[model samples]
Each structure stands twice: as C-alpha cells, then as structure tokens.
Target: MLEIRTLYDGTGALPAPSLTKILREAYDGELFFSDSSSRPLIVGNFVQTLDGIVSLKIPGKSGGADISGRNEEDAFIMGMLRAYADAVMFGEDTFRNAPGHVWTAGCVHPTFEKEFHAFRKHVGKDSLHPLNVVVSGRGHVDLDEPLFRHEEIRSLVLTTEQGAARLHQRYGATLPAMVHALPGDAALDPSNMVALLHAEYGVKLLLHEGGPTLFSAFLRQSLLDELFLTMAPQIVGRSRTGERPAFSGPLELSPEQAIWGTLLSVKQAQSGHLFLRYRV
Candidate 1:
C-alpha cells in the first residue's frame, strides 16, 4: 500500500469537507479548499526532479512517470486531486505526450477508484468523469487521440479564431469534443478561458496537468490559484534547451514581477518523494 506521512499542514479551517475518511487516511491527512465564486478555481499539478526538470524531452519517455520513477504514491495523490476537480485541463502538448491517457481518478490509480467515486458523489459531481479540457492556440492537435474518442469524458478544446476555423475545416461535426473559439490569433488569454469555464460549464475547480509552455502562460498571467507539486528524488541535469525543460518553461519573470506562493501543506512518502500544496 502507498503511504504518505503528513509533515506539515497549514490549511486554515474551511467550511466544506472535501475528502472522505478513506482518502484522508490513505493520504495521511485531510484535504480542503477555499471556495471561489468569481471564476473557476484553477490548480496545477506537476512532478519535477530535484534539479527542477519537468521533462526529459525524450521521444517516448517525456511523461511524469519517468520523473517520479513510477512512484505509486505520487499517482495516488494525483488521482485524489483529480477526484476533487470539476474539470481536468492540459495544453495540447501535454495531451500529445500521453497519447492514450484519460484524465480521471480511476485511470490514474485504480486501487482507490471506489473511494474517489464516492468522494465525487458526496460532493455532487454528476458526470461519471470530470470534463477533459485542452488548450490549443493553433489547433495543432491530433483529434484521433484516445482522449478525444472517450465516450465518458466530455472533452472541450479552447482555441483561437484561426485555430477554430482550421479545426472546423478539418473535423467539422465529426469532431467528438466541443471547440470554443476565443478572440485571438496565437495565445488565448488565461483569464478569459477561466471565465468561460466558470460561466458556461460551472467548473468550480479546474486541475491543470501541464506542459511547461502552457504552465508558463498561466503563471505569467497569475491565473493559477493553487499548485500541487510533487518533488521526486532525482537529479536529472538539463544540458540543452530542448532536451530537458524546466517547470517554468520560457516565461522568465523579472524580480519585480516574480510571484511568491504560500505553503499550505506538505507530505512525504516512504520513497522520499515530497508532495507539496501551495496557494499562489
């Protein structure tokens, strides 16, 4: 069994109970979130090496599994977070990285599937799985990917006007996911995307599983409210620009504009992986 030891928890008292006892025990503590009414509460999850490398950029080994060394505890924590989110989102490149992956609690950690479903049900989530959201500014996505064809996962694509036109021209009504075009040519505004999810889909909690580029955009715009970071005990050195990428991507923040995060909770697994929660 995967075991997590809570090292510190500073999440102030909240009104709503988010996790079930089963999940709490497995996680070694309770989980809570402050409510947001203006826009969808956006949270990002990432696992990085000790040296701050998020991906090795290899042909077939670019996913988090390699970074976390296939740690089951990290997967369980990610699955638990997915259970709390109303929608799970990622950039197009993230989808391309994981070709056949599904953004659901059960898909990530089947051992805790029942507990995840029970928690979601108790929290009044109607969908069998959380909505899958993909952000593709240029619409350079492979529509035939397994996630697009998932019957249970209602997928939504946020794209630019030009990209939407391209998608319509190529896929038309045959496309299984809903494509929403926003006013832009290259990059869609993160705030606008959050507003769309909050106003249209009632997405109170959105989990961001990222490719570094998308994460840079969100972080630059200050759109991410919380971050769940898994610190894997590895030292993957990045020698080149494209081979190994940092978690911050290309958006360099000046000292004056640098954002600081407030630590909410910290947990450690037996395998020396650290799970950290931060309010940004």
Candidate 2:
C-alpha cells in the first residue's frame, strides 16, 4: 500500500513517508488485516545481529558493542507494529526482565499509568483497552508491578488452571479482572487461545513479542502467520552456546513450508538500521 517496489536483487522496500500516511495506507478500510481462520496474526518481532545474535550480553543486561546501529530502528519497527495491532502478546519473563512502558505519541512512558488512559482511547476500546496478554506457565509475576495499577488497560494472564488459581490466591485483589484459566496445564494453547481472543474478546489482530521459549512454542505449534524480524548489524557470539534458537532441535516442517517467507518491505530508519517485514 505504501507504493512498495521490489529491487532486482530480490528485496522490497517501503519508501520513507510520514507516519500518518504510512498508517493510512497500511490499514485503509480493513478493520482486521489477518487471516480470520488463523485468528491471531502472530508476528515474531525480534532483534538480532547480522551474525545471528539476538542479545549481546545476558538476557536482560546491557553491555558490549551495539552492532550495526540497529537498536533504534528495531524500536521504531516495534512501535509501528504496536500502533497497528489490536493486542500485544509477550512472555511473562519479558515482563519481569524488561517490562515495557506504554507507547504514547511516538514515545514510551517509563511508567504505565500516565499513558494508560490515552493508550486505551487510541485503540478505540476505552471501556477495556487492547488486551495485554502474558503467557506465564509458572504464574510467577510481581503483583506490585506498575502494569497492574492501570485499570484502563485490561491485562489478561493466560496460564494453567492451577496456575490461575495460584495467581488468584496470591494476588487476586491486585490482578486484572480477566484472568483466563486455560484448559489443562493452565498454559495457553495457541490455537485455543487465538480462538478465544476472536470469539470472546473481539480482538482481530495480535502481535507476539517473544522471549524465545514462547516463540518456540508458537512455531512448534505452527501458529505463526507472519514474522517481523529486524536483523541488526551486531553479533553476540555467546548467545548460541547456552540456549538454542527458537526453532532449533527436532521440529518438522517441509523445506518449502519451513522456509516460506515473502519479503514485504525493507526500510532504513533515521538511525541507520534496516527494518524488514516478511509474510511467513
């Protein structure tokens, strides 16, 4: 929609345009932009170095060379995706490690409450707000986190029934009103979860921000519809040693299906980083 053109070398890029213009073109009249049957349009958003390093130091620490000048670009891409999605999905660990601040007018608020009201209004669901879904198998979340105070934004904690019960018993009063108990281990079933969001919550598009384990689960279940990866020009040689990539080990998918990704767009941000979008 943004006048995309494919380069001869097998790459497509979206020309630089104003933010409002880009949104108008991308969404147009489509209330939803995902496959309805798929329900949740899982967009795997992650940042990695040109050499395939997702994080430079440990999972949450910030040290080492910031390769390829990609951090700002990655953040911009994420902000754009957040602006487009109806809901955002993240692993519980991401919350604990790097709890995100609510985005407001192209900026992120360090605390949640100040921007909470405006964020709900932006999504056109001020009554309940766009769902902030967290997948926590063990139900280990800090009840006193700033996210809980924002009543305007409804937070949905997806866990096993047992886990849900534990969360209730521990922080029932502090927890959000919509604590859904999943079918068996309380862990969310991707297919079932997507169905619930569509059938019950009226969410048409979902953006998944991963922390590897959850990413692996979605891929293993074949629930991902698209992947938005930002290949930063940096590398972290140590990341591969301890934990494997999201799709590592014995996962099965035909070569065509497994490697099926169509280039959508590539743009160089003001910070000199590349943003890539692909349909998986």
Candidate 3:
C-alpha cells in the first residue's frame, strides 16, 4: 500500500512514476476500497486557470501562461487515471472541440503507448477499444474528426432519438454501432446515461472529464462519486469573469457526506511545477 503524506516545504521533488502505475495504485489505494462497500462510480476533473495560468510565469493568450509545469503534471495524472478507467466519459462539446489524443504528452516513456493501447483494447471488444462516451443533445458531431479514426479508442455518441437518426444518416458507417437513445433530452439525463453504461456495457469504473457545463449537471443530479482535483499554486485572476468553476450554486453534499478529500501526495516536476492530488 502507498503511504499518504503531506509535503509542506514544497521544494523537494516526488519520485516520477509511470502514469499507468500511479493510476493503478490510486485505484487499489483508495477507490477499490471504497467500492467494496458502495458501488458509486469514480469521476475526475481537470481545469486550467483563467489567465491561461497553469503556471505563474508562462502566461499566454488562453489565460495566465502557456502549459505550465503544474498543468502538464496534472494532465499527465489525469491521463493515467483515464487509462485505468473502464470507460472515459466526456461532454459532447468537449469531444467535438478537443484534439485527438486528449491526454497524450510528448513524453517518450515506454509504458505510455502500451497503457493507451490496453485501454483501447478494453473498449473495442473483439477488435474494438475502450469505450469513448460522448454526451450530445443535438447529435452535432463531426464524423471526419481524427478522434474517430484512432484505433485505440471507439467513440460512442449518446444523443436523442431524433438526433441519433440524423447522425446515423449523416455519418452512416463512420459512427459506432451503438447509439443510445434516452427517453427525454439525452444530454440532460446524466444519471440515466451512467446507469446505461453500467447496465449495458459493463463499465464499472467511469471517469468524467468535463467542460464545466457537464460537471455542473453531474453535481446537480448527485451522480458524481469522487472528485480528483490538482490545485496548482498559481492563480488566474483574469479572462474568466463570467465563467464558473465545474461546480456552481449551492453545494448539496450532506454534513457527513459533504466532501472530505484526503491529500494523496505532492510532487514537483523538473520544470518547477507542483502536482497535488486530493481524494474526495
């Protein structure tokens, strides 16, 4: 078992472990234990500061800085978690806009590709890959996107019956074989969607990588199980006046169930960035 500790000095570097290894450890370390009592799915979230401020010094157009050391480390952590998950869930907007290989860094580690391929294999049973679930209401997705072409990932677009029909006609053979049509507005029904994933696909572990709106919806429905957040030291004080954090409005967690996140670890990257993990 990995020992949990706090690093107050924030100067030393934590040993850099393979992303896949770290993810597996995180699950075996905490999630698996929790699941023994209750079967709530695990979910994770990653966000950059408004000033494009992933780092304090590398401020670029997006907000605070270019991809700072902290941002990179958090992203790598998120990637590892995703790799370990049975399925990677995302909002329709995130899917249509994000570039392919959403979590791949430029690192040439031996395990990077291998871990990703494993996830793909899990999704595409028989020759398929790890299920890539996208939530879209209008079914407005681009079939020619590189994400669909990736052999390591199979895309499952969840939309309404009308939208699914339209997408089927438009994309035809390009889309995944299964297009789930919910009873009501598909995008609005996250709980039902999660149940569908578990009941139909046997996806026991679900990691939701969000784009704010989806996060808000998940929280609203009380469907979120656990939250993994990496809080970088820098602040993004601008370019986000109107935007909201993933969770907005009144927090609904009960006093006992109210969020009690345990600090997992803190690591400083070679680029002088800090990575902090909390298990909520």
Candidate 4:
C-alpha cells in the first residue's frame, strides 16, 4: 500500500490517507459552491500518465491501470469522491469499457466500502447509493450490463430522440428510471444535461468520470468546477494506434475560449504519483 503526503493544500498543510479531513470539510457543503443559484457544482476526477494518456486505444479493451499502474491511493481517493457525490456520472464509452461494473461507491472502490458508506451517511445522503448517470447522445449502452442489473444503484440515461426510440425497442419495459432526450437536433448539451440532473435528481454536486469526449463537452460548456487529477509516473509516449488524449472529440476551447483554473491542492503517493486539485 502506498502512503500519501500532502505537499501543499490551499486550506492547510496536511498529509493523506488522513486526507479524509479535507474531504469531510468539502462534504459539509463548504467546498462546492457558495452561490445560492447554479445548476449544481460539477467536479471531475481522473488519473493519467506522465505522457498524458488516460487509456490506450487497445482494439477492444480499455483500462488505465497500465498508465496509472492501478495505484491503491488513487482507488481510495476515487471511492472517497464517489461517496462525496450525489451521483457518479460517466460517458457511455467509459461505462461500456467496463461491462460488468456498477458506479456505486462499493463497485468503484470496494476496499473502502465500509468507510465510504459511513461517510455518505455522515454527509446526509438520502439514499445509501449515489445515482448512476450515463451520458450518450446516441444511447449507445449495454442494456444487459450490470449498470442496470445492479439492485442498489439507480440508473438514468441521456440521449437523443432517435436513440431513445431505439433503446425503447430493446429495453422498453425494463428501462431505467429515466431516459431524457435532448430537444430537436441539439445533440446532448453538457450544460443543459447537468441542469436537468440538478432540477430532477436534486443533484447538487455532480462528479464526472470521463472518456475524454465527455470531459471535452463539460469543458466546452464551462460546467466544470473542480478537477482531481492523478499524475502517474509512466510515459505512454504516443498511440501505436490512433488513440485519444485525456480529452477527445470535436469540442474545442480555442485560445479565445480558454478555460483556466487556479491550483488548489497537491499530494504525493509513495509510488511517485502526484495528485493535484484545481478550482476551475
């Protein structure tokens, strides 16, 4: 097991796995948004390589373990964030990569399950499990996957009208609680989708676990608040295949549309990975 040491924290200097104190304060509604009006504060968490690869463009498989080395510290932090969130959100491609997975705290970070749930209850989450939300403009998801079959987690889908119709044909009767389609031909609007999640699900703090393109959408929409990024100690160099970077897709934040964030916190695990937090 790798231990964590805080190099710098905007709040104060403190070490981690004892980092829970910092997380606890954030969970107490102190760190999200001070404003009264907004469509829920959006936070993103990801681990990437020193060379900036999140996952390789392997033919049919997707995993960041090769890049991140599957560090224990990262897993524990991931679980902590899931517990802190009202819902753990993912893009369809990322969810599809793990066919047998659920987005619940236990599923993402099982070793920390007991403590993770305790923290959830500590933060006064009405349900023990955070909702599992997947974004897919075309509703490209595995209806038979464990994301739906999991009894504890609530699941929802966001897609286009035509995609909804197709999903209805395959999973009409057994569809998850909601299948919200975008208006007209407007594909999936990250801001609008997030606003709906806040209005409908009472999600005040949304956490995004991404597959590049989706992260790009949030960036394009300026809906992201905070980012927890783990800088792993490997170098993926370049894609042997035409792979994507940590953020993919057509959405661009050009020079005029640049998004900048202030550095907030930093930590280092024994494995030489650096964990950084940013206020975006």
* Top lDDT prediction, candidate number: 1
Per-residue lDDT tens digits for candidate 2, residues 81-116, read 665566777777666765544322143322232233
Structure candidate 2, residue pairs in collision: 49-234, 159-186, 160-185, 160-186, 160-187, 161-186
lDDT of 3 by residue, 1-280 (tens): 2223334322234343223344444323222213322333757655454333222222233221233332544555565566556667777655654545432311212344565556445434243334777777887877666666666556677788877888899878767445777766545587778778787777776777765567667776666666655544555553335332333223356676565566654655444455455555
Each model's lDDT comes to 0.89, 0.57, 0.54, 0.75
Error (Å) of candidate 3 at residue 236 is: 2.3
Error of 1 at 85 (Å): 0.7
What TM-score fits each model? 0.96, 0.74, 0.68, 0.88
Give the clash count for model 1: 0
Q: Model 3: C-alpha RMSD to truth?
A: 7.0
Full-model lDDT, candidate 2: 0.57
Ranking by lDDT: 1, 4, 2, 3
TM-score of 1: 0.96
Q: Ten residues in a row with the worst lDDT in model 2?
A: 1-10
| Selected candidate, larger lDDT, 2 vs 4 | 4
Which candidate ranks first by TM-score, i.e. highest? 1
Regions of model 3 farther than 4 Å from truth: 1-40, 50-70, 102-111, 115-129, 173-177, 238-241, 244-276
**Candidate 4 lDDT for residue 186:** 33
